[model samples]
Target: MKIKLALIVILFGLLTTQAQDKITVAVGTNSTFIETYNKNSWSGNFTLNKAYRLGPTSLKTLKDGVKTSLKWIELNNSYYKTFQKEVCRFKTMEKESFKFHGYVDEFAEEMTMIFYGESDGSFKIEIKPYNSYSIFITFTNLDMLRGFKDLLDGKSANNEIDDIFKK
Candidate 1:
């Protein structure tokens, strides 16, 4: 009986660690990266230094607009499409004032760990190919994105993963 109990305990421990190792990216998970810019037809040439951080989240409206796309560019990696599952997370950071900051998401797509701290209403993300043109993703929830960038820039660890569906 003693040997059986010990074996069971060991097996359970191993399973727990294995499950943790297979974590999928989602919101509240932080990330960051750096890319250089080259002039494009969409915007004029200019130098802009900015900081990405996750701060307070607030409400905003989504404006209606249409963009003319002259071309479609394919993402470099398909792994993100295969492994990354995007989902919504509801939370109100204890550190932030009791405002319902809303949902966040963390996922790996196109070789980048994306952390959109909070989605106020709407935003956009454009990932440049390994050796391609530079760009930016504009959004209402700037802090959450900033925090994610911090994670990418080594400002935070990417281990803040929690499995809500998996037991």
Candidate 2:
């Protein structure tokens, strides 16, 4: 009986560890972000843009590893699609003077990226979901920034690929 109990405990521990496993990717483009989630069964909000604003009562705190109801308004979109809400697991990461907040969806299928710097820098990005783990992508290069811009603009990847092949 003790041996059986030990086996069950071991199995439960493995499952718990797996549930908390995180996948981090340094995103360069919307396609990369999309592809990452698609291949991993994660969820994201591709329609998110700069015009969207977080609701006043949404995400009221900045504590790490906390779960909260995320609410925001997509200003550029219509009313039906404007106000968005989701249950998310909040996580934080600090690099240099910047702090990034990741809101992973309830089921851990997607992550919404929000960042603010100590010295007047802030931005947000939405990527599809993943499990109860944090997904943070830090932009450390120009290419990543450019790619992200293209993503926000809804640019076609075909043109980018053609340009690359032409070169």
Candidate 3:
């Protein structure tokens, strides 16, 4: 009986391990930050931009309407260059601080990107506006998106690097 119990325990552990999908990488600012993600959740440390940055451990490809897609958030140089012009709504440029009031559907040509809050229980998102050349954001797989909204509004982060020198 004891042997059977042990075998069952081992099998359960293996199953649980297999059920999780995870990825971790040290990306931007010379790899000073460690980013990680799994299945429906992600987290990372933020440092000012320098030579390079870190990438997420694992993530799904988040695509815009045009299918311009990106997976992990790192000090990815690709974002620095303006993506070639594609079919879209309008040219949006505004000097606004960190204030995420809604979801992605509310955006127009003025804001360039509109956001709206999801009434149904779904996921959460947090964004870090680094600057013109760099931006950082994270979403949650947890049940609610309330607690972390402040993070998107520039409340607190695990690691906030002083990138005054980057400018």
Show where candidate 3 strays beyond 4 Å. Answer: 1-32, 36-117, 130-134, 143-167
lDDT of 1 by residue, 78-138 (tens): 1122222121221222212212332233311122212222123223333222233432332
Ordered from best to worst TM-score, the candidate numbers read 2, 3, 1
TM-score of 3: 0.19
Location of the lowest summed lDDT over 10 successive residues in candidate 3: 4-13
Q: How high is the CA lDDT of each candidate model?
A: 0.22, 0.26, 0.22
Encode model 2's per-residue lDDT on 27-81: one tens digit a residue.
2211112212112335532321111111112223211202221122222222233
lDDT of 2: 0.26
Q: How does residue 157 of candidate 3 score in lDDT?
A: 26
Clashes of each: 15, 15, 17
lDDT ranking of the models:
2, 3, 1
Candidate 3 on 1-167: residue-level lDDT in tens? 01111000000011123222322222222111212223333444332222112112111111131122122111123333322222122222121210132112233112122121232432223322222323233334321122122222222222332132122
State how far residue 125 of model 2 sits from its true place (Å): 7.4
Top model number, lDDT:
2
Candidate 3 structure lDDT: 0.22
